[model samples]
Target: MSKDFYSILGVEKTASDDEIKKAYRKLAHKHHPDKEGGDEAKFKEINGAYQTLSDKQKRQQYDQFGQTFEGANAGGAGGFNFDFGQSNAGGSGSGFEDLFSDLFSQTGFGGSASSQEKVGSDVAVDVEITFEEMALGTEKKVELYKRVLCDKCEGTGAKDKNTKTCETCGGAGKVHKTMRSMFGAIQQVVPCEKCHGKGQIPKEKCSKCGGDGVVRDYQKVNIKIPAGIEDGQTIRATGHGEIPIGGGHAGNLFITIHIKPDQNFKRSGDDIVSKVKISFSQAALGDKIDVGTIEGVIKMKIVAGTQSGDIFKIRNKGINREDRFGRGSHLVEIQVRTPENLSRDQKRLVKKLQEAGL
Candidate 1:
């Protein structure tokens, strides 16, 4: 049996669209996975329920057929493709056929049409930075060979900034297309080949771009990498990706940061951890030793009677904290070294001290 979406949202079947939207927003905010005490499964269920109930057509179909529509729940609520299969319950196919045509047309299925253009494609790039750069933050310039707006046309694709209604689509931006499917002939409304859904064309094509608003060219982009950013973290720069062929909003550029490993230091959360070797005399008698940190070398005191694996902290010597004020501490682990290759006289002195229980 299908789950009752109305019950899931705590609303009546006749609830208004505004009521459903309000309920969805409240529940979504409360159950958002990023929030404290949020339930991921419950949030997805809420989203799925809201997805069907919020759409007037889908809601109507759900009310009539429950979850019987093929591909309705595929990929959860994020999936948009829906297939209203042939009705098995005996009845006139007129209602279902009308709905099929309406559904396909409004939802970009078959023989149906839309006026909206697809957005541009996103681009991703990897950037390698040194450990010091990761701790201090830096900017880098990258050259990308991607689609860029034509310099001569200024993204208009017209020679004199003049355009005319598309002759192929007759300014409708979409044309009818028919194909055979399981449910007999399905006509699809698709974007016109000539105007590319813009319903307009340049009177004179750009010599550089050849009527397309964008051209393949090299573009230099400046990226600012933030301090304390972790490896493999991506930063999105909007409008820096490839523009669509027919000219829509440019996509985003995702930069994944790769930090080079440091030989001496390792980052743990906000703190930096490192190991330093101390001699037996230094561990037993106490001494000040030089320790390497992100902020250069610092003098750290080793307490008397310190044992191996003892840790000392140098405050404010690690990477800068990105969330709040002040910096992280540097933790230095101590390793006491034992003496080797003792002379006979040295061994006799050690034996005398051992006999005296020193």
Candidate 2:
């Protein structure tokens, strides 16, 4: 029986072109053979389903034939054979060549011509920085494990040798198989495992990288953190990730920033807070007091009859804005201190004045 292409990709029959492509990309990545616990058969099934659904003509025929399109083409075999040799025989004039190029490009393969330009996987790393550094921009050097391109073979996975056409798929790079299902018999094509979808095999494997085209080594990268960057923020560096297999493009690197807490200052959104202690006499009588701020100490005038726990705000003295805005204010809380011990003469004068009431 024919398999339901929509059901195979977990999409509805009326799914749009974008929806079909999205579903196929997700499923293909999940079930890719190189991934852990990936099922090659499931990946191939979805790939075939997507190939049919993504094409307007193929989708129309499949819909008319109840997802099989068994009579779309003539000859003993009703299905179309995606033969690369036949498709490329016309020298770029063939319709199948264009279609294959589009498919390969969307699937992360550089192009159909080489199919060996695979990019490496991305890497994520965590880093901690001081709050001051976050406030003022700083650069840091980090060390991590990355797969570097093979220096011995220059990422070719071959050492002083060449490669030959893959025998399993006959350089077509895919193997097609028919399966019996409830709907009928469905044909699916999958990557050739022996050549890893490259359609070619290396004659001699590299001694340093062992045919993988990458070597595990320690890598140091310098990352510049912008000013006013918030905690838990992430930054990406392009082409700084692991080296791809067989000399492809390198993946990106993701750096997550973690800001450390400060001892004297507390952060609240874009603002900062601090405590300032003043004598009781200074609070009773207006006086000039030195207030600590992130920039430096600034003189502030205290009003007469000022009470304890009173807060004073200094304009534009706090953390800078991170989202293209102005700077924030600094909030200072006042703590009034009283005399711990009084002289005997001072106590006598206070008592005499209270008794006489003069």
Candidate 3:
């Protein structure tokens, strides 16, 4: 009886390659033998299903003939020569090797041997920018005291550029091992311990970094903050963190943005809000008044009988919108101020107006 690969992986027949890979990863992690309550049989089953569906040509063949395709390649599921004494998890030698390779490339699955190579650690830093700077994009230069690639060996970790390929794994950076499990013998590919998966070793280690290919030093990194970036938003600076030892990809630098509060303006989504004080006369009659905005102070009209807390908008003067082509509006709130002290003549005029019911 042919195995249903799609059903085993819990994916539809029309599932995309990413969806299949994701399903396989989830199932593989859940059923791994090394973990508590892990099922070796189920892990093997998931690997087999992933092995058949991940390949384009093999998937087409399986869709057409299940596992009984005529003249199917020896490396595929249809041509497996089952040995009851051995693990039936793989069709041929290549299937298990391919499975390990694919799994290792995607994520780390811990084992007796190294499943992943050592990489540099990620670094995070907090950056403070003014509210005006957040409104308009700006760049900041931050000094980081961390590991950087060695200058003497240029990250090769060698003396006078002297190096040789690792003999244990034959420069492949990985080696194959067979282990007995509940299901039977399973072959796995693991990182070579001799060269630490670097594939090469320095004949004489670099004096400055002691073969690590990195040194702790101070470096200034420039981080660009996008326009209208919110507080607590993070910006990733790729390849700017710690450089790996013995030469690998560098890790990333994460910059968290902190905006300084503005005394005159407050942020509300894409718009900015500000309050402007107007005298009672100005509120009672229509007049033009200067209002504060993010760009600058601009003239705004105050209509007759304008009440306190009335809002007016100044278009295109708020934060810059990076996603689209435009700026947000600036909202101005009116505060009407009553006269505190009145002269005798002013009191007499008010008294006369009050008498007339003005």
Candidate 3 clashes: the total is 0
Index of the highest-lDDT prediction: 3
Using TM-score as the measure, name the better of candidate 1 and candidate 2. 1
Instruction: Name the lDDT of candidate 2.
Output: 0.71
CA shift of 176, model 2, Å: 5.5
- Listed per candidate, the RMSD to the true structure in angstroms reads 11.1, 8.6, 8.5
Q: Report the lDDT tens digits of candidate 2 across residue range 1-358.
A: 7578899989888887767767877787788655688776776666567667766676788888764474343223333343334423444333334343443343444455435356678889999998777766789998979899888877667776467788998876655555443323444344565665667767888899888778999999999888677789999999888876655678889999998988778777777888888987788787999987878889998998888999888988877755657887888888899656779987786567569882
Candidate 1 residue spans exceeding 4 A from truth: 1-115, 179-188, 324-326, 342-358
Worst 10 residues of 1 by lDDT: 88-97
Angstrom error at residue 257, model 1: 2.0
TM-score of each: 0.64, 0.61, 0.71
lDDT of 1 by residue, 97-207 (tens): 333343344422223222246457788999999887887678999788888888888876888767899999788675656655432344445567688677889999988
- Runs of candidate 2 with Cα error greater than 4 angstroms are 1-117, 160-201, 296-305, 338-358
Candidate 3 or 1, higher lDDT: 3
User: Any residue pairs clashing in model 2, and if so which?
Assistant: 1-183, 1-184, 1-185, 2-183, 2-184
Clashes of each: 6, 5, 0
Considering summed lDDT, which 10 consecutive residues are worst modelled in model 2? 73-82
